[model samples]
Target: MRVALGVSYNGQSYDGWQSQPSGRTVQDQLEKALGKFADQRISTLCAGRTDAGVHGLMQVVHFDTSAERAPYAWVRGTNSFLPRDIAVQWAHVVPDEFHCRASALSRRYAYSLLESPVRPSVDAGRVGWVFQPLDLAAMQAAATRLLGEHDFTSFRASACQALSPVKNLLRIEISRRGAYWRFEFEANAFLHHMIRNIMGCLIVIGQGKQAPEWIDEVLAARSRDAAAPTFSPDGLYFLGPRYDARWGLPDRTPAYDWLP
Candidate 1:
C-alpha cells in the first residue's frame, strides 16, 4: 500500500532533505524511524527538496510499505522514534498513481528576513538579517519582473541538475510586518538556489544598491555571474506543494501560521 505523509522539520540539524553518507538528513531520520516502526525498510519521495538550514512547514512525501497500519497509527508510531525537530503531521492512504512530486500543480516557499542594525540572537538561524532598512516598493517592483515563464539560469545554481532553466513563476508576494519582511513565492517548479539568488537581487534593490530594472538585465544575460550572490538558506521555508482536491491531502500544517 502507498501512504502519504505531511512532514515538518527544522532543517538546522540536517544536511538537507536527501539522504547522504553521513545519514544526518531529514529523509534518513524519517526512513530510519519508519523502518523501526514497520520492521522493514520504507523509502519516501518528497514534493520538494530543500537545502540545509531551510525549514519545511508541510513537506509532503509518499512511501510504499507492506506494513498494515491505520493512518493515525503511522503518524504516532513513526514519530515516536524521530527527533524532536521533525515529525509526521498527518498521514493518508494514497492511490498507486499518486506521486509526491510529479503529481503536484505548484509549490510554495517563504523567506523571513529581519531588517535591523543589531544582529539576530534569538532568531539567528530562523531569519535572514540585513542592517539597512529595505525599500518595500523597490523590492516589489523588482519581483514583478520575475513573474511568468522565463529562463532563470541567472539565478540557478551551477550544480543544478534540472533539465531546463525555464520555470513558470506564478507569484511573488512581499509584505512587511514590523521589522520582519516576508517574501512568499509560488511556482510550477524551481531550480536549485533559484529563490535564494532572486532574494539577493531583491535585497540589493531594496537597499538602494540598484534600480528595479536590474532584474531584467540579469534575466537577459542568462548567466549566474550576472545576478547577485545566493542569499542565506537560514530564512527559507518550504510551504509544500498544491495537489488536486481529489488527493484529499492537507495543504498546510500548524507551522504555516506560526511563520513570520
Candidate 2:
C-alpha cells in the first residue's frame, strides 16, 4: 500500500532534500529512521527538491509499506526515530497513483526577512537577518510586474535542468507583519531557486540599491545574469503543494508541518 507523509526540517545540517553521494540529506536521514520501523527501504518522492540549506514546512513524500500500520503511527513512530531537526507531522494512506510531486496542481513558497537596524542573532537559522529596513510598498509594487505567465529565465538557476522556462505566477504579494517582511508566492510550478532569486532582486530594490522599475527590465532580459544574486536559503520555504480532494485528502487545512 502507499502512504503519504508530511515532513518538516531544518536544512542547515544537510545538503538538500535529495539523497546525495557525498553529504547528508533529508532523504538519507529519513531512510535511516525508517530502518527501525520497516524491513524494506522506505523511499519517498518529495513534492519538490529543496536546494541545500532550504527549509520546508509542508514537504510531502510517499512510500510503500508491506505491513499495515496505523496512519497516525507513521507520525509518532517516525518522530521517535528521527532527529529533532527533522520530523514527520502527519500521514495518510492513499492509492498508488497519488504522487507527492507530480500530482500537485500548484505550489506555494514564502520568503521571510527580518527588517531592522539591530542584527538578530537569535533567529539567524530561521530568517534572512537583514539589518536594513526595506521599503515594503516598493517591494510589493515591484513584485506585481512579475505576476502572470512568463518565461522566468532570469530567476532560474544557471544549471537548472527544467525543459521549459515558462511558469504561471498565480499571485505574488509582499506583506509586512511587525519586524518581518514576507514575500508570498503561489504558482503552477517553480524553476530552480526561482523564489530565492526573486527575493534577492527585490531586496536590492527595497534597500534603495536599485530602481523598482528595473524588475521589468530583468524579466524582459530573461537571462540569469540579469537577475540579482540568489538570496540566502534559510529565508525560503517550500510551503506545500495543492492537490484535488478526490485524492483522498481535504481541499484545504490550517495545519502545516513544513512552514518555513
Best by lDDT: 1
TM-score of each: 0.99, 0.93
lDDT of 2 by residue, 10-114 (tens): 788889999998649998888778757775677778988898888877788888889588988878887888889998877899999998888999998887788
Worst 10 residues of 1 by lDDT: 251-260
Model 2: residues with Cα > 4 Å off, grouped in runs: 250-260
- The 0-to-1 C-alpha lDDT of every candidate, in the order given, reads 0.96, 0.83
Per-residue lDDT over 1-260 for candidate 1, one digit per residue giving the tens place of the 0 to 100 score: 99999999999999999999999999999999999999999999999999899999999999999999999999999999999999999999999999999999999999999998998889889999999989999999999999999999999999999999999999999998999999999999999999999999999999999999999999999999999999999999999999999999998988888888
What value does the lDDT take at residue 110 in candidate 2?
81
Name the 10 consecutive residues with the lowest summed lDDT in model 2. 251-260
Residue pairs in candidate 1 whose N, alpha carbon or C atoms collide under 3 angstroms: none
